[model samples]
Target: MDVSQVFDLNGKGAVEALALVEAALQEQRRDEEVKLWFKFDPPQPGGGETLFQPVGRRLRDAIKHGHAVRAMPAQGGGWIVRLAAKVR
Candidate 1:
């Protein structure tokens, strides 16, 4: 899913984005994972590591049941978020 369409790097936006992603995943019939892309603006004050923290927390908190979530830097200047069903 296009995270840009759902999130804007703000607290409220992060919540909304996670909701959308969770809903989408719930509706899917296949076992394929869901991936989201987010492009963040350059870090302000606290340096690079602080950039995606809030969104990352929200993503992790949104997971329920047996889903797994992870976020990592993308090739460009953004983050790649992934969500998948947990393996047994």
Candidate 2:
């Protein structure tokens, strides 16, 4: 499944968005071939920043023990995280 369909942030607050991601990861565990990518849009300038770092850290930890994969931030403020696990 596409990452967008599996995870969404439509109008939902940040906390809920993080929760949704956690839940999806839990479910993906059943399938060994699942891969996940979480992309967060840059916060509006001057707007309070989202706690993406902490959340991202925790996510990294959670899947670290599993087959999940993750990506670190790139230059120019672009971040891409990919979680992949071997199926079968």
Candidate 3:
């Protein structure tokens, strides 16, 4: 089955981002395939890395662990995060 959803975290921060991503990854694990989006383009020129590093780190970890695919830059200021379900 294929699933699709969007997480519009425009003004929100890394904490919320991580939570949403984790939820998506968990949900994806229940299916064979899934598609998801997260609107957190980040990198507000000169913005402190500490402020956005968590989100980046979380995504990186997910990719490293094979829990998700990758975050692609969208036309809008966001990320089209593609996730893959974990194998049981």
Best by TM-score: 3
Give candidate 3's whole-model lDDT.
0.64
Q: List TM-score per model, in order.
A: 0.45, 0.59, 0.65
Model 3 Cα lDDT, one tens digit per residue, 2-53: 2277777666666766787677666665455556666655567686553245
lDDT of 2 by residue, 1-88 (tens): 2342334344556678778767766666443344454545556688676546655765777667653576455232323445566466
Ranking by TM-score: 3, 2, 1
**Residue 67 lDDT in candidate 3:** 74
lDDT for each residue of candidate 1 in 1-88, tens digit (9 for 90 to 100): 4442323343335456556555654544445566666555646675435446665565566454345466666554455666675444
- Using TM-score as the measure, name the better of candidate 2 and candidate 3: 3
Q: Which model, 1 or 3, shows the larger lDDT?
A: 3
Which candidate's lDDT is highest?
Answer: 3
User: Candidate 3 has what TM-score?
Assistant: 0.65
lDDT of 1: 0.53
